[model samples]
Target: MTFDSLGNLYGTTYEGGGEKSEGGGTVYKLSPGSSGWTETVVDHFLPTGQYGVAPLGEVSFDPHGNLYSTTSLGALGVGTVLEISVNGQSRIFSFDRVDGAVPAAGVLVDARTKTLYGTTTGNIYNHGNVFRIAASGQETVLYDFCQQPNCTDGSAPFSGLISDEAGNLYGTTEFGGANGLGVVFEVTP
Candidate 1:
């Protein structure tokens, strides 16, 4: 979960909100009230649709207060990057399997550039990748993991990303390094 400037905490659930059979998941907000804390369902992911389901990470907010995250399923059965704003929720990008698939984490928003970055756990190469979504919604694979021999560069990034002031991205993989035990990596993006 992440705290907005207003101190409201935001996050997502991997399941719930939709029909019991569907269990598409939901985004929610927690606000600290005078007496106690209040919880509100921000967005309910559809049980069946072209949109995504099973959100697996915390929600991120851009400078404009627009929320962003990824789903582990839907949109051709791969996954999607989504946005929630005053205009309502929308899928900003979908994984096609070739470029990447299964984003197991949320996105990192560059408040200044309005760009989003995240990692996928699988791709055509089955090694995962780091991607960039431009403010205009164009998706680019910034770095494909396991590019080096023996995948010493790491593979299967199953977490979100963090950036330094210099704009370098850092995250971890679930497996595939020198010892086949996963790795923490950095990307220039």
Candidate 2:
């Protein structure tokens, strides 16, 4: 769960919805009311939609207050990057092996530019990649794992990224350092 600038709490559940509703999951909002905190289901990911299901990360907001996140699984057999707003929910990007697949991390929105950065756990490399998707639907692969012949650089980034003032990104890989252990890496986009 994460809080917006307004102090409202937002999150997704891997389960729960109305009777007869497909069990993809639900997006919830908790508002601070005079009595206490009240919860509301803002949206539901039904198992039947062309869209995705099985969200597994914290929600993050862009500068304009739209929320962004990823689901671990979806109907297409690949996960997705989803955006939510008062207007409703939308799928910003769908994962496919050519570009990338299986996002293990949620999105990190550049508050100033609205570009999104995240990691995918599979690719032709079978190691993973770091990618950037713009609000305009363009996806850029910033780094492909196992770039080094033996993947000495790193592999399978299973977490989100941190941005520096100079426009650099830092993240961790689940495996592949000089010693075949996990590693922390920095990339400039």
What are the models' TM-scores? 0.95, 0.88
Q: How would you encode candidate 1's per-residue C-alpha lDDT over 60-134 as one tens digit per residue?
A: 999889999899999878899999987888889999988799999999999999899999999999989999999
Q: State the weakest 10-residue window (summed lDDT) of model 1.
A: 14-23
Residue pairs in clash, model 1: none
Give every collision pair in model 2.
Answer: none
Q: Write the per-residue lDDT of candidate 2 for residues 68-169, one digit (tens) a residue.
A: 878767855678888888888788888877778888778889988889999888877678888999879788999999988678889988888888999899
Query: Best TM-score goes to which candidate?
Result: 1
lDDT of each: 0.91, 0.83
